[model samples]
Target: MRTTRSRTVAALGVCSALVAGPLTAPAAADVADLRLDQWGLDTVGAAEVWEETRGSGVTVALLDTGVVTDHPDLDEVTVGPDLTGQDLSPDSDGYGVHGTMMAGIIAASGHGIEHTGGVMGVAPQAEILSIRVAAEADAAGGGETDPGALAAGIRHAVAEGVQVICIPLPDAAFSVQGDEAERDAVAHAVDNGVVVVASGGADGEAVYPAAYPGVLAVGSVGADGALSEFSSRGEHIALTAPGEEVTVLDADGGYTTVTGSDAAAAFTAGVAALIRAEYPQLQPEQVAEALTGGAVAPAAGAEQPGHGAGVLSAPGAMAAAGTTAESVPPFDPELAEQLADDPLVPRWVLWTGGAVLLVLLAVVGLVVLRRRSADPYGLGRRTPETERRPVRGRRRRGRGRRGVSR
Candidate 1:
C-alpha cells in the first residue's frame, strides 16, 4: 500500500451516500471461491479478454473514497492525495470501503501462490491510482462533497498520464452542473486522450459529470443481464454492466457484495483499460466506440430506455477497437421519431424556407428567360439603343465563341 499524502487535509468528512451496500465479512476465500461469485467478469467476457491481454500497461485512475492499498487481492495501487479531508487511516469509518470495492472490480490481482485466491479484477494486470475524493456521508449530511476537489483530482489523474479515470460516485452524489470546473476537468481528461467512466447514478436521471459529453456513463445489470431497477435511466447511459450483488474487496481485506452503478462504472473502466492496452494507438473516443460497437442489444431486439448500446462485451470491444466501422446506436425508433419532430428548425419553418428558395430560383429563371426572349443575343441587358441599332453584320449567339461583326 503506497500513498502520497497531502500536507493539508480539509476538515469536511466524506463517505458513500450514493451506493447502497453493507460491509459483511466472509470466511477466507480462494481464487475459486471468488471467481464463482464474480458473475460480472464472465458476463463481460473477461475470460476471453485474458487470453488476449490482461490489460497490461494500462493505469486506471479511481476517483472515489480512498482505497485500502494493503488489500491482499489488490496488487497494484498507488494511493494519491486525500482530497476528501477525512481520516486517511484504513480503519476510519467507511473511509475507503467504497473506493476499495471499486478498485477490486477494476484491477485486483488476487493473492497467494499462483494468485488463485481473493477477489480477481476485470483487468488483473492493470494498475490503479486510487485518489480519495470522498467517502460515505454521515447521517447528519456531514460528508464533504467538494466539486473543486473532484475537478482537481481529475486534472491530477490526467496530468499523471493515466489511461482511464473511473468515478464510482454519480454526479448527484455531489452537487455539480455542466460548464463547471468539474465539467471542464472532464473535458480536459478527454482532450488529453484519457477515457472517463462514471456512474449514471442510481436515481432515474443522470446528473453532472456522468451526463456530461464524452464521459462513458454506465448502468447496472443483474446476473440475468436485465437492467437493474436501481440503476439510473437517462439518455447519457453508454452501456450496462454487472453491478447487482457484485463481489468486491472490503477495506478490511475481506470479500463483500455491492450493488450499484458504481461497480458498473468500475467494471467498464477496466474494459476501457483492456481496450487501451490492446489498441494503444486508439484514441479515447475510438476506445469508446469499441465499447458501444461491441455491445449486444437486449433480447427483445429493442434498446432499453437507458441501456445505451446494450450489455458490454469485452471481447467484442477488443475486436471492434480502432476500426472505422459504424454500429447502430441503441435507440428506440418510435421514441427517436417523437424526439426528432422537435428539430431546431420546426417542420413548418423548414417548409417555408424551402418554398422561399424555390420561389427565388423561379423568379430568377423567369427574368433570365424574359431577357433572353427580348434580346435574342447573349450580350448585355437589352436597351432601346442596342435594339434600334441593328447595324451589326451578324448577331452573336448566346455567349458563343463566334466573332461579332461590329
Candidate 2:
C-alpha cells in the first residue's frame, strides 16, 4: 500500500483506550469493499455534494502533525508547508501519520497508490494545506514543542488565503496563547469570509482553537451513532461527525484505529468546503448555521455527547446552505439561564465588590482593634493605689505611711 499523511474527539479516545480488539488490516478498497456506507457514512449524500461543489478551488488547511504528501490518497495536497521541523519523508515514525490521516480525510486521491489499500479519506477532492506545527511525538522520534510554531503556522495559513482551516492537534498547557493566536487568525479569515473547523481533544474537553468562540468545534460518533467515550462533550461542540475505527498502521505496524477524531475533524472541514462552494454567497456565520442546523441529534443514550446538534450530515448541510432557511436558531434558554446565574461572575465586578467590602471591613475592624490596642485599661485606668490598696493595711508595715511598721 502507498503511504500518505496524517490522521478523535475525547469520548472516542476513552472508548479506544478501553477497547481491546485484534489489529485489523486496512479495508482493501473496491467500491464493494467500501464499508463506509454500511458504517453510515452517507456516501450517496457525499456524491450529491460533489455533484454541486466538487470542492472546486477550495483549500482546506490542516494544522497539526506532519503530512506525508506523497501518499496516493493525498495527490491533491499539492501545496503545503512544513511547520514542524521533523522529516517530511514517507518512512518516518508511525506517529507522524496523524497529519497524513487528516489530509486523507479532507482530500486523498488514492485510487492507484500501491501498498496503500485501506486508509482512505472522506474528502478526496478538496485540496489540503498542510502546516505542520509540532514535532513528531511518535516513532519518528520527538521534536521541538513550541506553541509559537503553532501560532505562526496559523498566521501563515491566514496569509495564504485558504478557504477552510482544520486544527486537530491540542495543547496540554490549557492557557490562552494558542487559542488567542488561532482565534485571531480565524477572525482574520472571517473578515475575508473563511470558515474554520476544529476537532476537540480526545481526553475530556474541547482544545484551544476549537474552544474559542466563532470557530466550529466538531465531535465524533461511533458506528451505532453512540458517543464514543473519547468524544469530548460540551457547549463548545458545534457539530458531530462519524469517527469510527479506521485501520491505521499502529505502533506495531498492525492496522487498527489507534485513534480517529483527527479524521473526523478533517471530514467535517471537507463538508464545510462543499457548503462554501454551494452557497458561495454565505458568510462564515451562515456556513456555520448550515452545518449546525443540518446536524442530526446524537444517537439514543448518547444525546448528551452531542452539541445538541446532530451528527455531520453533509447532504443535509449542503441542502440547507442552498436554501434560504432561517440561518441561526435562537440561543438555548437553559444555557442562557445557567450563564446568567454563574456564581463566579465577571472578574472586574467580583474584584470591585471584593475591594470595596475589604476596605470597608478593614476600616471598621481597624477602628475597633485600634480602640482595643490603644486602650491602657479596658474601661478606665486602674490607679496603682486601687490595685495595691496599701497592701490592705499591711502596706503600713512596709511604708509606715512613712514609718509605723506593725
Candidate 3:
C-alpha cells in the first residue's frame, strides 16, 4: 500500500508503427507473416527455443503498469493488486501502455488458427501475472515512480508462486539509495527461488532493483546485435537483448515499435521463463548462470560496452543449462556408492602427512641430542637394551677389539 511522488517513464520513445487503437482484421494468411517483421524475436533466437518449449507452465510476474488482457496476441493474464493508487480501467488515459508492451514482448500469442499475426513473444505459452506498480502516464503527461509499490509487488508476486518476475522500467525513474524495503523485497524473491529480471536503465546509469545484488540486470541491443545507444553500461549489467525499435502491443490493442530497456528486460524475463519451464528444479542462481555463461559476445573475449555478458542466445543458454544439469547430479544412492570405492583420504593429504611425520622425527632427534648434552641422564642416555645391542657403527669396532685382545 506504500506510494511515492517520483515519476516513472515507460520508454525513451514510442512511435506508432501501425495505426494506434483497435485495428481491422487483416487477411488470414497475412496475419501469420506479421511476425516476420519482428526482428527482435529472431535476434533472441525465439524460433529455436520454440522447438523445445514456449515457456509452458511458467508464470511471469510483471511489476509495472497495468496490462490489457483483451489483446489478441496475449494469452492468459491474471490481474493482481494496483499499488499505483490510480484507476487502471481501459477508459483511463495511457492505461497499461508500458505494461502491455512488456507483456507482449514476454508472452504475446499470435492471433489466428495457426497462431499467426500480431506479435509473438519469446515465451508465447507463458502466462502473465500483472501487478500495477507505476503509472504509464498521468494527466499532465508525467507519472510517479513508486519504489514502495515495487517492493510490495515483488513480495506479492513471490507469494503468488511466480517463477520469474519482470520489471521493465529501463530508466532510473527514481533513486533507490537506502531503500531497504525494495532491497529486502528483491532479496525475498531471490531467496524464494524466483528469478528477478530488470533493465539497467537507458539513461546510462545502473538503477535500483536492477542494481540489487541478486536481480538479473539487462541492457539493450539493436537489431544489428550492437549495443544500443541508450543502454546503461557498468558491472551491474548481466545480459543484453533486442530493445531498440522492438515491436510490442500498443494500448489500443494494435502493434507499435518502441525503444528502451523495457523490451530488453522483458525478453530476458521470457528467456528466464523458458528456462524455468524446461528445468523446474534449477535454482535461481543456476538459471542466471545459464544465461550469462551462455551469452555470445561480439568477439571471443571481447567485451561489449553495455551489453553485459553479451547478446542473449536462447539455444546456447539451453545447451549450457543441459551441461549444468548434467554436472549437478541429482540424489542417487547408487551414485554415492560409485564414489565410495575411492579412497577416503586424498593423495595430497597422505603425502603431506608422511612429510610432516618425517619432520617431527627429525625434530625429536635434535631435541634428544640437546637434552642429552644438557643432562647426561636425559632421553639420549643409553638404556640396558641399547647396551646389549651396541650401536651399529660401534658393534664392528667392539668385535675387532675383542679379537685383538684374544
Among the numbered candidates, top lDDT falls to 3
lDDT tens string, model 2, 1-406? 1133222122222224336452223223232243343253353246556656667667787786766644433566644566556545445554345666566566654332242333344555677777877654443324334556666776777788777888766333233335556567667777777787877655455567667767788777777777766777666777777666643322222123434455567668888888765556677888888888887766576447544477788888887787743453433435666787874477789889999999999999989888888784777666876685443444434434654556
lDDT per model vs. reference: 0.77, 0.61, 0.78
Q: TM-scores across all candidates?
A: 0.70, 0.63, 0.72
Give the count of colliding residue pairs in each prediction.
8, 39, 4
From the highest TM-score down, the ranking of the candidates is 3, 1, 2
* CA shift of 298, model 2, Å: 2.3
Name the lDDT of candidate 3.
Answer: 0.78
How many clashes in candidate 2?
39
Worst 10 residues of 2 by lDDT: 1-10
The residue pairs that clash in candidate 1, if any, are: 14-135, 15-135, 15-136, 15-137, 16-135, 16-136, 31-116, 31-117
RMSD values for the candidates in order, in angstroms, are 17.8, 18.7, 13.3
TM-score of 2: 0.63
